[model samples]
Target: MKYIFLLLATIAGMLQLHAATVDTINVRSAQMNKDIKAVVISPENKKATSTLYLLHGYSGNYASWIKTAPHIEQLVDTYGYLVVCPDGGFNSWYWDTPKNNYLYESYITKELIPFIEQQYQVGSDRINRAITGLSMGGHGALYLAFRNQDLFAFAGSTSGGVDIRPFPDNWGMKTHLGEYHQEPKTWDAHTVIELTHLVKPKSLELFIDCGTEDFFFEVNNKLHEKLTYMNIAHHYLTMPGKHNGEYWARSIDFQMAFFAQCFQKVTLN
Candidate 1:
């Protein structure tokens, strides 16, 4: 009897996955020949407080988050909010650079956000929009949000390669910056940790989470320390996991819930 009950329970759980549907969108940018893919998930039964603009990591397409974090449906199945997962390219680092053809910053700020606002039930205010990502996309999320405060109110990064100067010669970033030695300023200016100096801190809510066992943990820790030195208030979290889908999928839930809560409206007379 117990054996039969366990088998039935496992079957029911697998069947539940069919209930949620992911709507994918592909947008081509004139800034680059490449096409951007995004997955938009909205719940119809309950009204949600805000929208979560998600970005993908290096070598990851927009499908990464949706495929890894299947539990996203349960988190807000009743709360009618928007979840958007946008591609940051194989590894563009979400930069609008002096040399690169892809101006992802412009595409997201000028094109994608407008499309979302125009096509969906999105609020125009910055408070209603939040951005976050992992690894390369984590760098992108902070870089975009910090540079364009008017577009995003809350920002978070998970295991972001925050300081890129160390890898100036490694990643294809040299092509984007035209050699680090030749354009040191560009490299310094674009790094997420280096760019932190430009942030106003209090103007936007921020969160950063990284696994102590992750390769990028040192840089992420440096970012947390620097932000603290600057007297910036942010949610800094450390967990015991590596750079993988299992951790990221779990982390996004907390990020989404926190960002959604920030966008909730309140009034007092």
Candidate 2:
């Protein structure tokens, strides 16, 4: 009985040693002129040197990812990578609004990335940086990665509103791009589907997945077709689920695995 008790205690200690650590941090964004809240998760052993930025969806905050999908903490432990979850602000669509003070695009690409690099011991180059998100964040990830290839080498989207022009009145997008009928050209320039031309062949790695039942399913499919027509290489998947925490939780597993493979390839080359 004594030996068994000692063994059980040893196992518990080992598990505790390998658990992931979570921190709630505030990163200053000069573009937005305010400190943004973010959740940073680091592996217990601190072996992972790469970083992955995870963005939340509409009506969600910085804590949404971990709160909705707690398994992400375990994922960090399994994959050994630092994960940073930043608040994109409700309905910000991760864009620098022309009519509003929401400069989320600048906050993410210019401010948040530099803050993460400075605060964490992760790689500073694009090869070591990746970004992905659910819903609205999904569009933001691809938009930022496609336009700023020098900052992120890998980008993924799960059930993302890739094309905002389709739903101008929904998700407060009209506030950012103005009325679609009033400024049709501005809407076209901002939509990810229209920005497919910005993506050069083999310029960056991409992963995209959406549920057949998701409201954004049609748009995701359209974006995939556009990428294919543009001759851009990307991994796209469709599964049986809707646009909710259940689907995103499962989808994130595959995305992190894909990112791990990309990181390995970068290290090998």
Candidate 3:
């Protein structure tokens, strides 16, 4: 009994020692003129040289990922990559809106990325960086990654609102892009489904998945079809789940594994 107790204690201590460290950081966004809060998960050994920018859904903030999927901390330890969860702002849709103070597009690509690279031990190259999110963030991830292929080598979305034109009345997106009826052109330009043209062959690696029961399933499927039509290489998946935290909690594992494989390829070459 004494020896068994000692072994169990040793195992617990080892787990505690190697656990990832989670920090709440304030990144100042010059475009939005605010100090945005983000959850930064760092590996215990500080040996990670890559970073993953994870995003949240509509009305969710920086803490959303940490709160929804606590296992992400273990993921950091398992993958040995830093994870950053930035606040996209409520209903911002991660856009540099022509209407409101939601200049998130500029903030993320310009301010957030630079700040994280300088502050963390992460590499600045596209191969060492990836971006992904859930729902609104899913759209935001693909939108930003497609536009800035120089910044991210891997991009993914889980239950993303890829085509906002279908549900303009929802999510308060009108406050950012104006009503869909009035500014059809603007809506067409921002939606991820429309931006498939921007992606060049082999320019970026893509992973997209959604639950069949999710309301965003049709849009995600359409985006997948469109990407296939364009001959853009990607990984698309459909699993048994919904569009809630439970779904994302399960989906993030696959996405992280995908990114890890991509990162390894860079290291091998």
Which is superior by TM-score, 1 or 3? 3
Across 1-269, the per-residue lDDT of candidate 1 in tens digits comes to: 23323433453344333334468988767667667778888765544446778888888988888888877765545334688888777768899863657688888888888877776767767877889999898899999988999888889998888888877776688877778888988788889888777788477888889988888899999999999999888888888889999889867756765664565532110
User: At residue 73, what lDDT does model 2 achieve?
Assistant: 83
Range of the 10 consecutive residues with the lowest summed lDDT in candidate 1? 1-10
Candidate 2's C-alpha runs over 4 A off are 1-18
lDDT per residue, candidate 2, 235-262, as tens digits?
Answer: 8989999989999988887787788777
Q: State each model's CA lDDT, in order.
A: 0.77, 0.85, 0.87
Per-residue lDDT tens digits for candidate 3, residues 1-269, read 23323433453334444569999999887767779999999988757889999999998999999888898887777667899999998888888874587789899999999999999857989899999999999999999999999899999999999999999799998877888999999999999999999997899988898999999999999999989888999989899889899999888877877777778788889
By summed lDDT, which 10 consecutive residues of candidate 2 come out lowest?
1-10
lDDT of 2: 0.85
**Model 1 ranges off by over 4 Å:** 1-21, 33-35, 265-269
Which RMSD does model 2 reach against the true structure? 6.9
| Candidate 3 lDDT score relative to the true structure | 0.87
* Between candidates 1 and 2, the TM-score winner: 2
